[model samples]
Target: MRLLPWTGAGGKPCYLSTDDPHSPLSRLADDIEALHLADAAGVLEGARAVLDDPGAGEHAVRFALARAVESLGDTLRVAVSRGECA
Candidate 1:
């Protein structure tokens, strides 16, 4: 079973039960994971800065938070997928 990079509509973890690691979905997940990791540092810093500022606008905070949550979900999916292989 492989964990997909996106959650279901009900906020549940979605898993792909398959033996092929080279499937299209798996490759897409890998790409998404790579992109997230590459931008992690910048996103973390931006979010931290926005959160630390007392006068930051709600829009800025919300955007940062949304990105953080999405990135976390993607990272978790990748980890779960790798663990299944292990």
Candidate 2:
């Protein structure tokens, strides 16, 4: 939902920004897309075939994906902080 006047302190899994670069969601999406693009072709092709279950298999798969994306965001944050990223 696009906010007409949204006002909520962005909770910490993401960094909030008045600018989009500081938005964790934006950063996460970009990182995931990049990781998926930069892979050695079809590495993740079987992710879709995994069945949903209470076992750690599903959680592991999901957490790994999310962690990879978050790592990218973290890298970007560090890069920007070091004045190395645009």
lDDT of 1 by residue, 1-86 (tens): 66777778898877878778798987887787787676676788899999999999989999999988877666666667678433
TM-score for all predictions? 0.60, 0.34
Q: Give lDDT per model, in order.
A: 0.78, 0.47
Poorest 10 consecutive residues by lDDT, candidate 1: 77-86
Instruction: Give the number of the best model, judged by lDDT.
Output: 1
Judged by whole-model lDDT over C-alpha atoms, candidate 2 comes out at 0.47
Consecutive 10-residue window with the lowest summed lDDT within model 2 = 1-10
Off by over 4 Å in 2: 1-56
Residue 9's lDDT within candidate 2 is: 62
